[model samples]
Every structure is written in C-alpha cells, then in structure tokens.
Target: MEKRRVVITGMGTVNPLGHNTADSWQAVREGVCGIAPITQYDSSAQKVHLAAEVKDWDPTVYIDKREVRHMARYTQFAMASAKEAMADSGLDLSAENLERCAVIVSSGIGGISTTESEQTRCLQRGFDKASPFYIPTSIANMAAGQIAIAFGFKGMCTCPVTACAGGSNAVGDAFRHIRDGYADMALCGGAEAAVTPLSIGGFTSMRALHVGDDPSRASIPFDGERDGFVMGEGAGILLLEEYEHAVARGAKIYAEVVGYGATCDAYHITAPAPGGEGGARAMAQAIQDAGITADQVDYVNAHGTSTPLNDSGETAAIKTVFGDHAYKMAVSSTKSMTGHMLGAAGAVEAIFTALALKDGYLPATINYKTPDPACDLDYVPNEGRSADIHYALSNSLGFGGHNACVLLKKWEG
Candidate 1:
C-alpha cells in the first residue's frame, strides 16, 4: 500500500506583522516592515532596542480571562493561532474520531518572560512571591499541552524544542504522523513570546540582535548593510489532514505537503555550519523526496535571518543545492518584514509558502538596498511580485545546527 498523503487544510498566525494570518500576509505582501522600537518595556539600558512585537493582542479574545493568568504568553499565542486553525479546518469534533487528531506546537524559548519576572519577584520582592504557576507556565511543552487540552486533540501531543528550527521540525513531524497512518489529522506549528528583558539582553550580548532603531532597516536580509536579526514574537499553526480525508470533508486545501527533510551540522550551537552544508543537504533531500528537479521550485522562503552569516550561508546553500537554477528561483525572506520570529519563524514561513502557491504572489525582502555579493540570488526586493508557484520550499536553520525544510505544492485538484 502507498503512503498516505498530507494536505494543509487551514493555517493561523499571530505575529509581529499582524495579529492574525490575513493581516500578516497582507503586511508582508505590501513589503511593510513590522520591526519597531521596543515598547514592551523601557530599553534605555539595552543596546538592541527594536523588535517585531505583536501589537493589539488581547488574550481574552480566544482564551478565558480566568485561565489567562495561569498560561504564558507563548501558550496564549499558540491557543489563539490554534483556535483560528481549528475553526478554519471546519472539522466537526462530534462526527470525527477525536482519538485520531494530534497537536505538536514548538517553541524555542518557551516562557522566559514568565520565568524572568517570577525570578525577579522572588529575588527582589521576596521568596514567597514566586507564583505557583511558574513551573507549569514556563516549560517549553506547555504550548503543545495547553493547545491539546484546549482543543481536545489527544492523539500525539508533543513539542519539538529545536531552538529556532522547532516550528519546522513540528511541521515535518506532523506530516509524517499523517503520512505514516499514526494520525489522520494534526494541529502543528510553533510559538514564542521571549521578548523579555533577559532574552533581548542575552541576544544583544551575543551580538545576535540588530542594534538599530529604524524599523525598515532592522531586518534587511541579504543586504550589504545587514547587521544582525531583529527579534520578534508570535505563533503560527496549521491544520494538516490526510489528502483523502480533506477531500472527503470538502476542506479548502491551501497546499499539499510533499516532502520534508531534517538534518544537523553537529558543528556549532549558535552558528550555522560553516557553509550551510547541513541546510543544503536538507534542501536537497526535500527536493529529492518531492521527486522534483531544482528548477521546478518557483520560489524559496529562505531562512535569511538578516545576519551576515545566515544570509550568506543560506545563499551558499541554495547555490550548492540548485546550482545555476538557484539564480532562476525567486527567493525572499518574509523575515525582512516580520523580523525573526524565533521558533515560530518556520511555521509562519511555511504558511507563507502555501499562500504564495495558492494566491500566485510572492512576498518581498523589504529594505534590500545594497546587495551582498555572496548573497547574490534574486531577493525579490522592495515589492511583491506575481508568480504561479507550483512548488515552494521553506527553510529553517536553528541554533545547535538543526536544519529542516518543507516542500509545499500548489493544490489544483
């Protein structure tokens, strides 16, 4: 018997660019940068002051106000995105086998803000002030656990904690679950809300964050002027179902999950493998699994973090995998607009790839002024371009040398 096929039925995201998927997509398409001066707190002491913080978010919109205090912001973001995804899927819980559904949400830095504040209160205010919910709320798996409990998806609830690659890892893992007959459907993605004082300060100390106040210039991937990534926070979720099941339910298919590849450099904790060798391998394996030539991929949602190393490394990876064809593909980093969404970056980008295939439009790498020669591929600079993408690839390379890639094909049937 052939392996089952997986299709993305619904997607939802709450990100720096927008409060929801629609708004986020529109903002990226318009080449509008979401990075702004940090308003979460006074950053006068921090060297990095800009971030793509989610705005106008009201947790009570999707979660109960009473339960909100117990949940971390990351969990809240996950729940909000999951709520939209579940509703968009149109899956009737009463009619389906609830046991066949699953949830896998990822987070790089789970609830650091919660941990930081609680630790601060415990140290400064008193040891008695530490909230009892600290352990429950600060763990990385709570996003998956809480989302599972909230939606009652019980099959295989888990979290992939692969640093920045967590989101793509969860997505790829979910695809396998549906394909291998372990589950018929899965709610999978990633979330993060680690934009606290500690996270910012830590990244700043490591020189991994952009030290700029200009929103438009903060995340200019592939640009010669690029410095470091602009940190962002949010969640992105997708409802993936077996192809036949989705068709039977008259589900609105956004795209089909054709291939997934995961690899690790075993090289470094913070830096990508010297030349993005692991990333190139993952991209090659994904395309091979898709049974498509490099030229068939019309667009690439690059893991261009705007950092000099990452942008150049990803470009080298593309060239290594695609060779001359790499120059032909329209590649862009939505991170140019949404900033670096940490663990949620890959899932959000996977959604962008699907939407690009479905809508026939590619989001641009905004603020691309001076192009770095090493990163010479077409960055789809400045404005959104129209393209009938049959196959799109999204890349996510994280700390600890984790690399994951997913291929999405336009669904016409």
Candidate 2:
C-alpha cells in the first residue's frame, strides 16, 4: 500500500533562549547560550547549580489564571507551544476536519515542581494538605490530554514516555498514524520542566550533570574538556498534516517528514550498547525508511548531550551507519546552546533541523574549542553555516536504551 505523505506546516517552541519559533531559531543560529545560575530556587547546596531555564514566560497570557494554577509548569509550557503551533498553522479546529486531527505530546518526567511542592506540603502540614489537583497536574499524559481538550481534537490522543526519546517517538508515532490513515493531522512534540531539586539531585548522584560554575563553558558538546550535560527546561511542538491536506489548505510548509526509526540497546538503563550498535541500527533504519542512501543525507542533528559515553558512542554510531560519509556530513549538537532538555530535546532539535532546511542554514555546536579524536566530524563548530540542506536527520537517545531517529526533507511541492 502506498503510504500518505506528511509535512510540517508550523512549529512552536518555549526554550531557555526564547518563547517563540522565530526568536528561538535566531538565538540558536547566533549561538546564544541559555544556561545560567539557578534562579527559581536556592541552589547553593546543589552540586550542579546552573541550568537553562525558560525566561519571561507568562503562562497567563495564553491561559486563564485559574487554568494555569491547575496545570503544572511542564503542562503550561506544552500548552503555550501548542497554541503557537496551532496559530501558526492557521488551522482552525472549528473549521478543519476535526475528527481526523490528533494530539501526541510526550514528557520524560512530568510535573516535578508539583510533585515536589505537594510532598513539601505533606511534610510541613499533613497528608490532607495536598492540593486536590495534584494528581491531575502531575500525570505525564495531561499535556496531550489538555491539548486535545483545548483544541477539541477527537482523533488519537496519546503520549510516548521514552525518556529523552519521547519527543521523537511522539512525532514518529504521529507520522505513522497519518501514514496509516488513522489521522489526517497531528499536533505532536514534547515538553519538559524537570529542572527541580529532585531532578538535579538524581542526575548529580549519577554524575550526569556539568558542575562548571560558568554557564558559557558548560554543555560544550564534542569539546575535549567537556564534563557533562546542563539540565534545561522547555517545550517544542510541531503542527503536522498530510501533505495533500497541507497543500490544499495553503499552509506554510516547513519540511517533509519522510522517515522514522527507533531501537533499544537492551544493555543498560542509562548507557548505550557497545560501539553504539543500537544507535547505528536506528540511523540505518531511518535511512532505509526514507529510501535513501546514507550519503544522501545532508545534515544530522546529533544527540550529543556533552556526556562522555554519549559523545563517543554516538560518534561510533555515526561511523557505523554512514561510514566515510559521516566525515563529510554537517553534523552538530544544538544542545551546545540549549543545554539538555531531556524529553523535549528531540522536538527542539527536530525544529532546528527543519529550520535548517527551510532557511538553508545550519546552526553550530557552540564552544567547540577542543577536538576529541573519537568524535571527529564536521560539527559546524562554533559558527552557523549557510548550506542548502536536502535531507536532515535528527537523533535522540535516552535512558532505558531508547534510540530514535527522524528524517526531514525540504518540501519539494
């Protein structure tokens, strides 16, 4: 059976650098660093005291005060991005084919702030001190559920919880749904707001966070002196529709979703398989699904999290998948500026890839001062480059050995 084609018509993001797509893309292309000292709370005791936090985000501007109070910060971020994406798409749910539109938003850790706050209240006051909205606010699927309710989407509404791969998985699943005729369009992506005390403590306990006091020096992916990933909080959402529907509606198409691949290491809960065998398989599968050779891919947005294992493992995966062509491809890690958004990483990086295709420009991996022998590739080091990208691949690797890859191509029509 011939599969339906899918294309991205609009995108939205709430990141540490900016709140909207244009501003975020501009900041990224300019190599803006979003990390800073933790200002939301007292981080004096935390080993990793800095994080990339979303600034000047007024949720009340998008949602009612009462509604915002009932939702978690992660949910608020997701809704804000989703609203922007829907508006950008110019697809009025009231006029569109509502039954054929769906929502798939994922999160790695949901509502950490709510969970921490309720726990504190329980300890400070009593068990009865917990807010009645605690359960609803803390669940991971509420982001997708609220989006469905907000937009009155009657099609599939689901969330994929594959740690950092959640965003890519959500988008991949949404694409398959449309391809398989389950839906005509989808509001898909991920949100994360886990930069909390418990999150920091957990990651620090595992020694997975960079403790560099200076924000600019942290999250230096592919840098020889890199320590670890800087925790970040934000959301990225994309409005995807079947290609024909998008064209028929005269939507502003950003890119075409051509392929998707996912795999598991089955080796460790937190580490990649030896030589990145799993990641290689995911990349290869995505290439195959796109019906293109590895050499045909113009760029790759890496899962480069600035961690020792990930950088080396991903480097090996690229070699295994692309062979000598890996050296020629324009690969980069936008995490160099946005820090690690965990579940939201894939969505934002996918946006970066789409923007690269749209604008014929590739954002750089900033602060690439030193070279690692293991990670030798054209990382677009420290500066943006103008390139006519034909096919862009975005990868996401996460805990539980999850790996996902999505291929986006320039919209030809």
Candidate 3:
C-alpha cells in the first residue's frame, strides 16, 4: 500500500524567548538570548546560577482559574500551546471524526516541581496527606493526556518519554499515524517545566548544567569556551493533518514532514557515542526515508547542546552523513538562544526548521566567538540571513543514547 502524505498546518510555542510562535520566531531571528539569572528560585547556594525560564507566566490566560490548580506547570504549557495550535489550524473538531484525531505530546521530566512539592508535603505531614491529583499531575504522560482530554481527541493519545528526544519523537509518531492512515489529524509535540531547585541541583551534581553567570555566554553552542547546557523550560506543539484532509479544509500548510528517523547508540547512558555514530545513522536514515540525497538537505537544526561531547560529536556525525556537503549547508543551534528545553527542544527546533523553509530564513547560533576546531561547520554565527532552503532537518540527541531526526520540505503548493 502507498503511504499518505503529512503536512503541518499550524504551530504553537511557549518558550523562554516568548509566549507564542510569532514572538519566539522573531526573537530567534534577532539572535536574542533568553538565558538569565535563575528567577524561579534562589540559586545563590548552587554553583549554576542561570537558566532559560518562561517569563511572566500565567496559566489562567489559557485555562480556567480553578482548573489550573490541578494541573502541573508542564501540563499548563502543553495545554496553552495545544490550544494555540488547534485554533491556528482552524480545524473544526466538531466536524471531524473524533476517533481519527491523535495527541502525542511528550515530556522528559514531567512536573518535577509537583513531585518535589508533593514529596515534601508527604514527608512533612504524611503519605496519606498527598493530594489526590498528585499522581495524575506528576506523570510524564499527563501532558498528552490533558491535551487529549481538553481537545476531545480520543485516538492514540500517548507520550514519548525518550529524554531529550521525546518532543521530536512525538512529532515523528504523529506523522506516522497520519501517513499510515491511523489518523487524519493529530496534535503532537513536547512540554517541559523542570526549573525547580531539585531539577537544577540534580543536573548540577551531574555536571550537566552551565555554571556561568553571564546569560549571553552560558549556552554558547559550538564555541570553544562553552561549559555545559543551560536548563530551559517551555512547550511546542504542531498541528499535522493528512494531505487530502488538509487540502479539503483549505488549511494553510507550513511544511511537509517528509521523513523521520530514530536510533539508539546502545553505548553510554549520559554521553554520546564516539563521533556521534548514532546521530549519523538517524540523519542518514531520515534523508533516506525522505528519498533524498545528502546534498538535498539545505539546513540542519543541530542538536548542539553546548557541552564538549555533544558539539564535537554531532559535528563528526554531520561529516559522516553529509561528507563535504555538510560544509555547504547552513547549520545552527537555536539552543544558543533558547538554551536546552530538554524534551521540548526537538519539537521547538522542528518548528524553527519549518519556519526556515516557509520564510526562507536561517537562524543563527548566537554568542559564538571562538569556533571549536572539532566542530567546523557553517553555524550561521551571530546573525540570521535569508536562504531559500528546500529541505531541512531537526535533530535531537538525548540521554540514554536516543537520537531522533525529522526531515521537512517547503510546501510548494
């Protein structure tokens, strides 16, 4: 049987850079850095002093005042983004088959704040005193579940907890569901709100977080002076529909999700494989799945996590997959500005990739001063530029050796 086509009709995001897609994209294009001194809690005692936090957040804007009490921060972010995406798609859910709609929102560490608070309460009082909503709110799958409930999407409601690759996996899974005829429309992405003291302290203990005080230099991916990743919090959602269904509804198409590739290194738990072998396989697989040659890919939203291992390893992976053509293509890490959104990174970067195709622009890796000898590529340093890219890839490499890549093409029609 022939596979169906899948197209992205809408996108939504609530990131440290902005509250919506327009604001976020604008900030990205302008090379704005969102990392700042830790404001979610007092970080004076911790070695890491900075993070990318969503500013002035108010859940009541998108959800009911009373209902907000039951939802975790991650769930709230997911719901807000989903609502924006659904509205942007203009798909009348009442007119469509509810059973054919899917939701696959994901999170790497869902509601760590909720877990911390509830655990504290349990310890201080008693285990029986824990809130009834505690279990429901703290689970990683609750983002997907809550989105499904709010939007009445009853089909294939699930979450991908693949560490940093969770968000990209969510988008890829939704694409498969539509392309394989299991669903006609889907809302998929990832959300994360783990900016609490416990989350920061844990990453700090593992030496996974940047210990810098300067926000601009904290998440400087591909740069020689980079220390580690800065924790970021947000959500990003995409509305995907079968090509025919989207065309029939006259929905505005952003781009075509042509290919998805996922792989595991089977090597290390926290560190990437030597030379990013797993990431190379995923990118090659995505290109092959798209039925395109290596040279056809014009831009890469790299998984440049600012760490020494990831930046150098991912650069090697690109060379492995694309050969000399890797130098010809524009590669950038928006993480330079957005920081690492953990599970939400892939989905948000996917959105940036789609917008790059749609708007003929390439985002930049800001704060890049000294280039690493190991990572020699055109990182679109410092400033964005116009580029009529036809095909783009978004990459996400996570802990536990997970790697995911999604190939997107410009919507010609």
Cα shift from native, residue 301, model 1 (Å): 0.2
Instruction: Identify the superior model by lDDT, candidate 1 or candidate 2.
Output: 2
The C-alpha stretches of model 3 lying farther than 4 A from their native spots are none
In terms of TM-score, how similar is model 2 to the real structure? 0.99
In candidate 3, the residue pairs with backbone N, CA or C atoms under 3 Å apart (3 or more residues apart, or in different chains) clash, namely none
The candidates, ranked best first by lDDT, are 3, 2, 1
The global C-alpha lDDT for each of the candidates, from Candidate 1 onward, is 0.91, 0.92, 0.94
**Evaluated with lDDT, which candidate comes out highest?**
3
The 10-residue segment of model 2 with minimum total lDDT is: 91-100
What are the per-residue Cα lDDT tens digits for candidate 1 across 141-179?
Answer: 999999888878879999999988889999999998999
For candidate 3, write residues 1-413 as lDDT tens digits.
68999999989999999999999999998889999888888889989889999999999999999989989999899889999999899988889999999999889999999999999899999999999999998899999998899989989999999999999999999999999999998999999998999999999999998997988789999999988999999999999999999999899999999999999999999999999999999999999989999999999999999999999999999999999999999999999999999999999999999999999999999999997899889999999999989999999999999999999999999
Cα deviation of 317, candidate 2, in Å:
0.3
lDDT of prediction 1: 0.91
lDDT of 2 by residue, 1-413 (tens): 78999999889999998999999999988889998898888999879889999987799988899999989999999999999998999986677878899999989998988999899989999989788999999999999999999999999999899999999999888988998898999999999998899999999999899987988789999888888999998999998899888888788899999999999999999988989999899999989998999999999999999998999899999999999999888999999999999889999889989999999999999988989998898999999999988999999999999999999999767
lDDT of 1 at 153: 83
Error of 2 at 267 (Å): 0.5
